[model samples]
Target: MFDRKEMMEAFLCEANEELQKLEIEILALEQSGDSETSIKRIFRVAHTLKGSSAAMGFDEMKTLTHEMENVLDGIRQGRLRVSTELVNVLFACLDALNALRDDIEAEREAQTPTDRIVERLRAIGSGEAGAGGSAAGSGEPGHQGEGGGQAPFEVGEQDAAAIKQAEREGMQAYECLVKLADTCEMRLVRYYVVAERFNSGGQVIATIPELHMDLDVPELRFLVVSGLGEAELKAKIEQIMDVSKVSVARYALTEAPSSEPQIAVAAAAPEVRQAPGAAPVKEQEQKRSSQTIRVGVDRIENMMNLVGELVIDQTRITQLGHLLRDRYPVDENLEMLEQVANHFTRVIGELQESVMKTRMLPIGQLFNRFPRMMRDLSQNLNKDIHLIMEGEETELDRTVIEEIGDPLIHLLRNAIDHGIESKEARLASGKPLVGTVRMTAAHQENQVVLTVEDDGAGIDPERIKQSAVRKGLLTQQAADALTEQECIELVFMPGFSTASTISDVSGRGVGMDIVRNHIEKLNGLIDVQTKPGQGTTFIIKLPLTLAILRGLLVNLGPSTFALPMGSVVEIVRYSTRDIYTLKGQPVVKNRERVIPLLWLHDHFNLPRRKRTRDHVFVVVVGVAEKRIGLIVDELIGNQEIVVKSVGSYIGKIEGVSGATILGDGSVALILDVTGIFQLAGTPKKIGSAPDAE
Candidate 1:
């Protein structure tokens, strides 16, 4: 017996995928003029849903799908077509399906859901409550009369024979078993993959149930009509990673004539249509490959994790080697063993990196969705907007890509809502009616830079200052003293917004602050730039991946900290001459560039007794176009520190993004440079100060 919850989850998951496709296709059909084919596609989705619900004993879904199928048939036969009224009803049906789907997903929430819906159907001449292709929907009026609706005119004897003849002679058949790996990330995708494998082979034969059912099974079994033998089948299954195994069998989903190959046949009606409709059908099949074999993602990740353990083991063994070599100076083999161990260490390091790369998808995959979003938004707003996206191909850890979507969405909405001006205003200013927003990305040394710039109305620094003062986020005196750059950054301050009126979209000004906090949590930075009436641009600099970071290890007052390499420029020895106090703050001059220096001692609130040493080591950090020197006691040499932010409250005051096993085997804090910057530099206002009278 299968774990019932697992089976239900798998089924709901598959149904959801099909529903997504159906929604997209329906939307596309609305945009197209093809009513005949659209109805056909809709019917197919309904048929599949109907069969799956019946198999699962979901009576409500089965009834709903049945009603939907009838409506689709009415459209298919040219008696009805997609109208605004019909589409609205379809949307209602879609919503019902979605609600039902949600119930299946989390049945705990399905309290007294739609149990018994009204049944609507119409028959030809004789009205009866029987299944029919042209049955009316429950959402529609049910004509009250005898034999109002019936399933359909009964299939004639010749039509039934013709259907059997087509199945027996015209169609080919084969059995397909698609077994997913226990570690398969998405079982539905695996199902699609297996379907694609067979579809590429040739044709498919009959299968059980008059309708195709979407099973919520971990292992999807279907019979295909393919000419390929066992060898071809094995080769194809091996191609898809996470496909544990595939074993084909002879039996179809149902029993057929003994003289013909067994194939699944919808037992609902033995009748078939020899002349199928000529509507163009798209194949939603799975991916197929023949050379490579499948390996579970978990297995690979596990192997990489085990290698990490091996690294710790190697660290221990190396210590042992050093102790042994010192005790027995004449031992030649011990020294050689140390060298071999070092080699393995390098190999394991490279292997771990390679494994991580396997999970790295290009940022472009997420970025690609924005063009369509922009297109829709532009049309809806009746505003001419152009988006310039660059460096979208930059790759990041998949984990980062997933979380970044919503924040980016909020930013885009903010830009469209407040940053861009109306067409009339643009024309009055002699600018093009279409506003331009430029989004660029590129790797700088070790960090990824993403920028969103709009050429409409540049942000007003004075407005921000006024708002900041009003919100008590800043003192009026502080807002007055802020620079133009600092003014633009006020948006990052919680409860700080310059907009006077709120709209459906933005105006709350909370989004930018949230974006700032979220990125900071990821050890990333966000900044804004604007010139009044020219444009506004938000520049976000993020690490290559949240999973790994290159760090510079430093020591300050008995504590070790890691500075991200992407943020560091040069670690230089500085004398008191290089650093001078200006207005109570320490500043360092390097190559004629004044870099404000933050003392690690004072930053950490450690004991600040004056050091006798005159020379100080400074780590120069850069974010956006600004640079600052961080004062540390000494550089403990350069080492790669992987940043891991711990959340389960590990009980330590560890401020580092992650910890790494040092050659000396000690825990170190990976310095949050951006966090430290917030600790250090006074951010310049992001907008301009008012002009002096």
Candidate 2:
């Protein structure tokens, strides 16, 4: 209630982060049967999200999280074990939470329809969730916890109602005594797990002081409540992973542990979830001081940029030392300079690596939402769609994460509307009724490649051809010459889409071109490949960060320019006699093919000096299918340049992507080889329209 607006925004950020953690835990838990800690971890996340959602006044979020909490409560109580189907459902729940969270953050003022979801959740809680079961049916096998060696509790009516209210306003006061079982794996983790379990149902009231370090007899103790009867609660507790036993006890004013689950702890203040302990709250006050601290990304980016400039300057200084050494040869002082320069290079290289790492954010930030997105979209379309995500640990520059969000959403919408088939269609196609879309990420050289692939009906070449002609992307004659793959790629052309009916989401190519544009702005590329009836896949390759481009510097028309070394095969010297004119175009033969050549003087409109030299530097470059030679005056060696975009308007200048200031303060434009090649009608991947994969 303290500054409601601020609290809402803070809650949104916290929930967003927690939701991401929840998704990773769920995926990890699904892959391992031994992952009890992971399972408990996911439950705790759901519990945290539930509290935050209710606090933020998101009714839809609150409702879904509430049910999600219940399912988690069942897991905590040991009423159910995770199954493949269960994980899918949990992912769906997480997906919903994510979308609701998104809408809130965007200030979209949108509400999701979740009435049926509530009914479904209720059924899940009552043991009637799957097909024909009902809440009134017999409980799951191994769900009972009436004996010792179990931290068990059952969900009774009174406890259920109390837990609900507690969730709405935060949990009321309670105390717990936790004793670690002999079978416990990772005691500290279990202690965390124990603490998390209590907090999930309701916040932790208090724990025995000096217990973790002291390991005293009362060393193992925790106090918690969820508004459910102790027996119902104990039933759930005893079933936790690695838990040898569980006992739900009440705490007296004297900090005594009550043996029976039949008793109730009196409620205290609004935020208080535990009864008053002998120790003050300060004793337990976030002992680790592990709280979130926010810093503007732009500031870090600025700092990183400055560091990059230092590297370039450092390199320049070493070059200066080399220049001085040549003139004043063979001296002990010059030898020492050489040694010092080498060390500087080593240190700077490491420093650059460290800075790059600081900019990396996990792809999990985005993957966390797909589970929820797939669920809602699938249900709305009356199809069964499975989203398989891989390489969730893949990292990207923070800026890439933020910029790529909208584009990824667009692709997901495309997969749902254009890639996936309905249940009936899938069944008729001799495929499983449940279609699948797999989103994967992997590191390829200095680039991060993300792919979105579907198993539904692939793009039809004829369909794309017709659509292209309809949208005027190509003339009928042009469309006629396009192979199936070529036709599918046309979907990326502006104003191209095949959907005759439009929904709130997709059917227009608003997002595809944008996806391509943004990726290119990051010096990335996108490619699309489809099978006539198999499905479509979009592959995107992006640089590690926009802050730097690994470039090979070369002299162009009395000035220097950086060509990304990642694409350069080699630099070969071509004598003027070896160069010939092919149909009025300058060409050079290197290895096999006659490479189309661009003269630095003519391309940049710079005055050319008389050719006193015997050779022209051939900067051999390739991007996708394009292999061309940039005829330059001299090669200036390779260096990683901190890429800085030239300001607006001029940025629109074809073939020049960005610029970086060199050691001597002169700015060199970074050549967009892909852009230049495309302009010169060379075969190469350009922008978002990727070559087929």
Clashes of each: 37, 40
Candidate 1 residues lying further than 4 Å off, grouped into runs, are 19-54, 59-99, 109-307, 311-331, 362-395, 423-449, 453-455, 531-535, 605-613, 644-658, 681-693
Residue-by-residue lDDT tens digits, candidate 1, 617-654: 77888766678777676677665444444556763342
For 465-514, candidate 2 gives per-residue lDDT tens digits of 88778777789998887776667677767777788888876875577878
Model 2 misplaced regions, further than 4 Å? 1-13, 21-43, 46-133, 136-143, 146-299, 421-429, 460-463, 477-488, 575-595, 600-603, 613-615, 649-651, 682-693
Predictions in order: lDDT: 0.63, 0.69
TM-score of 2: 0.67
Work out the TM-score per prediction: 0.65, 0.67
